[model samples]
Target: MSRRFSPSNLFLGSLFVLAAFSFDQLTKTIIADIVMQPPRVIVITGFLNIILSYNEGVSFGLFSEILRGRPEILVFTSSVIVAGLLVWMSIAGGRLEAAGLGLMAGGASGNIFDRMERGKVTDFIDFHLAEWHWPAFNLADVAIVVGALILVSGSFLSPQQDVIGK
Candidate 1:
């Protein structure tokens, strides 16, 4: 059966995205303006710390240095991607799918906002094991990753399996 793109679903998806975006932006703003100067770090363990890090790159400062020095490319790319996602979300169906896209949109929007306004994204949560340290990340990154996982997992469930006990 074909799925119809309903207004209520669109609204719900948009609302979720907006909520996520707001939370992400607010946290980043707080960290960038109030927390980064002193750079407060809460040691969760020997390998994890909640430390404020202003990253200009996409993830874990991978392209941050390059993006930090050249903001135009990053800005343009993010804008296009975000716009494309929005368009896709507008027509996407399935409850989980809509929710996932909303999360991705919101997370991307939040980081994009930071890149545009603050010239970097504020990353606070850090994890490391042995010599390998993951890039510092924030709520938005978590949301995006979690949402993507949910979407991927959901894709594996057939309609019959979703409707009945599998």
Candidate 2:
């Protein structure tokens, strides 16, 4: 096997993937099925609330109208993206890159699993300032964003030769 796909690399990457996926799924289950049984808005702080929402589309509810009731398409698209992430992770040059890719893959997988089983993604984390509120999102979304940020920041911090394996 290639150096990038060494046992240690793959194990570390897989560990992140499993951790992200498990945590995302566990949080979703607890919030959706247990805490929000009655499905009411729960205010935790001045700026945050738990409001159960089902997102039928991609980020910010975009394409929800088109994607609603058509989860198969979303599932297919998301699966493709996850597969690509897995391939990238397998060949990642550094541990940081692999970890980031794994997180993205795991987050995507969580949402895809939701689409397949629930026909939509459950979102509950709500942040607001004054009257304006950001779109509600779940742990998976957080993981994806954090992973992307890590990858971007890593690129800037690491030497080009190290990242590119030159």
Candidate 3:
């Protein structure tokens, strides 16, 4: 009965969460099990390539030395973040904000799943310019970043409507 618990909001949140989560997991599976086997690089373009790598820590391999190969810590941290996002989405106004929260939750969940199943996150998307390169990342990371951007931008753009409207 409450506005925060409206069926429409729940539907939109569920739709985006399911979609993002499924896509993230599917892409990871395909990259890890099929495309990257034999551990060789696959070039997609001059600027893009696939070379599988495992991340034992958070974004950009930060805290890899701090975690020291303990996946449980990452799993717990990700679970907490995802839980917060889910609660935030429940009360968030508008489909745009809800979708953003949903995507964040889904992506976080996918990475948490990875930490649990493989003891690390599987990253395969590689971007480079000749000798210059960026750290490898996966689909879940993309979803989380874009979702956070959308959520933040939507809040600033719509203010009350995006965060607390009826």
Candidate 4:
């Protein structure tokens, strides 16, 4: 088998993708359907709260107005991105890169599923301080961000040969 398709790399990549996707969907379902039936905010800590939100657009609600009635566009675009991420993961130079790409792919998959089923993405988990409140997001979003950080930090820590083989 080619190095890009090594058994270990494929296993690790698939594992992260499945795990991230499952966890993200489970959390979203529980939080949005079971816990927040009435759609009210629940305080979790000094800076955290659970509040349900349906985002009709991309990250941070950008272009929401323009995409208000066009969910197919978001779904199509996101699906393409997820496919690209999976392709990258398959050829990832190291475990960290594979895991990061898998996570991003999984998160994007979850959002795509949501958009297809509900015509919007379900978001919750709000962070705030004083009067300033960050936009609400979900577990999938967390996975994507953490995965990105892992990839970045790994790049800085690992030797050049580890990333691009000698």
Q: For model 2, how does the per-residue alpha-carbon lDDT over 118-166 read when each residue is reduced to its tens digit?
A: 9999999999998999999998998899889878877776444344223
The TM-score-based order of candidates, best leading, equals 2, 4, 3, 1
Ranking of models by lDDT: 2, 4, 3, 1
For 77-141, candidate 4 gives per-residue lDDT tens digits of: 99898888887787777877778888888888888889999999999989999879998898889
Which portions of model 3 show Cα errors greater than 4 Å? 1-3, 159-166
For candidate 3, the 10 contiguous residues with the lowest summed lDDT are 157-166
Best by lDDT: 2
Q: Mind giving the per-residue lDDT tens digits that candidate 3 earns over 1-166?
A: 1236556766787777888889989998998898777789998999999898999989989988888579999999889988888887777667778888888888889889989999999899999999898999988888898888888788676544555334
The C-alpha local distance difference test score for the whole of candidate 3 amounts to 0.83
Q: lDDT score, residue 27, model 3?
A: 92
Q: State each model's CA lDDT, in order.
A: 0.74, 0.86, 0.83, 0.84
Q: Evaluate residue 110 in candidate 2 and report its C-alpha lDDT on the 0 to 100 scale.
A: 89
Query: What's model 4's TM-score?
Result: 0.91
Candidate 2 local distance difference test against the native: 0.86
Could you tell me the TM-score of candidate 1? 0.84
Better of 3 and 4 by TM-score: 4
